[model samples]
Target: MTSLTVDRPTTFDVHSPATGTVVGTYPSHDELAVEAAVDRAHGAATWWRTAGFAERARRLDRWRAEITRGRDELADLVHAEMGKPRSDAKLEIVMALEHLKWAARHAEKVLGPRSVTPSLLTLNHACRVEYRPFGVVGVIGPWNYPVFTPLSSISFALAAGNTVVFKPSEYSTGVGVWLADAFARAVPEHPVLQVVTGGGDTGAALCRSRVGKIGFTGSTETGKRVLAACAQRLTPVLMECGGKDALIVDADADLRAAADAALWGGMSNAGQTCLGVERVYVHTDVYDAFLTELLDQTRELRAGSGDAKIGPITMPKQLEVIRRHIDDAIARGGRALLGGLDAIEGQFVQPTILVDVPEDSAAVTEETFGPTLVVTRVATMDEAVERVNDSDYGLGATVFARRHGQAIADRIESGGTSINAFVAHATIPTLPLGGVGASGFGRVHGPDGLREFTYAKATTRQRFPSPLALTTFTRSAAIDSAVDRLVSVLHGRIG
Candidate 1:
């Protein structure tokens, strides 16, 4: 990574949130630069689409291999730029690779032309449907899980035969550039994947550009802005906004397992995960026991730059939001079961657990996006389901009931749910990941993900003509009366 900041007007410095040191420098791409990138992508898309599924698969496999070979270097940059533990960074890379492979392997079957049975009215016609590339897609990614999240869209988009112009979060610009460069190494024929680095302005420019589609991952407010920009040209958009995800615990749930999963889900990556468990609704029957186990596991956990299990908050400004949530919870008569306001130390925030917090508090209502959890007790699983569904953001969720986990998971108004596991739905390559309602729309994995980047093209061909020629001018009156009698005979079965 280049540490020196070029004294140019179109460049900015990227600093490590944990160390407060300059990590790399990236260009502050403007509207013109973004437009140029999209233009290049259009040329790439033309060649890429003509490259046949087999050849595209071969190139995508090479790209995946290149990423695997350089995984360590990419992981290191992820850690340095986003402050996630090196292990977590590697894990994200691993997941991204799996999805990439899945996309490459399954794109043909998912998007290739397939014959469809026509309706009775068009029985003489042969109908078929196929998904075609949207030419160029603009992806605006988030900082958290920088490598995995963007690739979730980029990989699928490429496999669907579309070129991409990625605008990674300013905080993780180096990682984005690194991934794009790796793709270039594997597929040197054309610029199928490109990265545009900058802040909100560059992202807005990408949305307003002539790209075929936009894939955005950020806050709900930011997602709305992206939609508004894309709406200018009626450009299609796929959004994966952040969520205030919750975990439901029933009396039949494995208390020990739930505690362990909750602690990790709420603290890992400094709790920066959009699907991280920020609110947990536990059954009163086992609330005390569950709390005991959760606190016991949390005792050894710490957050810092060194060998701590949890890393520093990737974005410095998020510290204030975490602190304010904790303060508001405590002021509203919430009891701290673990760390509290004092747990927020400079750049690092130790895991904090607040119990008996009001459901309407900021800690529960808004997305904290930090290492904090608020556990609330409910009388029954019905209440738990109701409370979890009450949120405006319907993203991913977790259910810990051993006996009725799937039933409860089915009722939660979220995109994906993990039964007796945490964030498990996201790791599986066969499942589509996205949110409902304010959590944003569209998916980014599995078959749905592959189709999200492309448009459906339907074709019809006349196999044969109908025997009854009702259009003949000589016998039109007689044919019309005959057709009316046939319709009445076919429909007169009603008693």
Candidate 2:
């Protein structure tokens, strides 16, 4: 086991939230080191892509088994680095394994060749589309839900036959290294996956690398910078940026279930999730009842380092942002039914709920990536829907209407929506996961995810000659006139 060290930063500490003691120090990688790793990955990807779908699937299955067998050890590493509860960490690992398995099983069907009908003009030639792997893929991951988010990109990329170079968030670099080690053991013959540990500079280097594509999950502001960096090389990107997602409650909705889902979805991992529910819109008929239930569930959430209901905020800098959101909400006349700005201590921010906050307040319009939520009352379902769609970020949304759940969900302009549940669509394993507008673009789940790392190649084979010859230098004026008449009869109408 060679200790991976670089000339960049020597020692960055990871502190234990439970004890506030330094736990570990990670070595950071420099540009030269990152480029070398990507260079190796490019060669490996060429070989791996040529191995065909069956061989890649077999390798992925073996990797999946290895991950399942060592799930506990891996979960422990995640818990130590990210300060998440052991159970939650285990759940993240399990979901990542599920994604790995799903990608392997479905890649062939999703990315395989398909025949398409040629236009009448080109009927003399046959046409088909085939997906080709991008040589190397670069993944910049987030600390919150570290395993699930990064693997969501990497698994799909690998399944599509691209090698990966991942730069995990600085807070969870150890866990990222562990994942790469596991993959190396499972597929020692090829360096198909590698981890580069560092802060923003390393991420920037990766964006500027010669990789075929870049997938990033982080704040919208940083996502903009990443897009700018990747633009230098004209590289394509799949960015899962920040989201201030909303949950709509109709007049006949179930308040208890909605409250439970909202509380968990908003406060889990200290609300560090990109798709966490940050806003709630409820009809005035059950507004009081819904708010009461939501506060009750929220007050019971305890943040600590052990087997607590919630963990500390993974990044230290986020605490200030959380405090500012609460302060802005309070100054704008929003009533704090639960916790307030002072509730944020160090890395842990107790669950805070604000009501009566103006729509123009920062808490309502901005991405408050913390354990705080804004609740507002609406007179009708249409108003609720309108309010939810007003934000620029449209990552994930929830609808709690029994009769019109699907209809309401379809109306929301978001990447994904759950009917009567929160974050349930993420676990379904068959739907696309991403957002529209400022929430960023591209997808990292299901068939869309499998295709994100590959380019479509259209192949046309000329077979027998057609009755009327075209695409030849010897074509006659008579043939051109006949083609025009045929097209007019087939598609034209006298308007």
Error of 1 at 201 (Å): 0.7
Off by over 4 Å in 2: 1-9
Clashing pairs in 1: none
Q: All candidates' lDDT scores?
A: 0.91, 0.87
For every candidate in turn, the CA RMSD to the true structure comes to: 2.5, 1.7
**Which run of 10 residues does model 2 get worst, by summed lDDT?**
1-10
TM-score on alpha carbons, each prediction = 0.96, 0.97
Which stretches of candidate 1 lie above 4 Å from their native place?
1-9, 468-475, 478-495
In the range 77-128, model 1's lDDT, one tens digit per residue, is 9999989888889999999999999999999999999999986546788999
Task: Supply the TM-score for candidate 1.
Answer: 0.96
Q: Looking at candidate 1, what is the lDDT of residue 268?
A: 94
C-alpha RMSD (angstroms) for model 2 = 1.7
For residue 93, give model 1's deviation from the true position in Å.
0.4
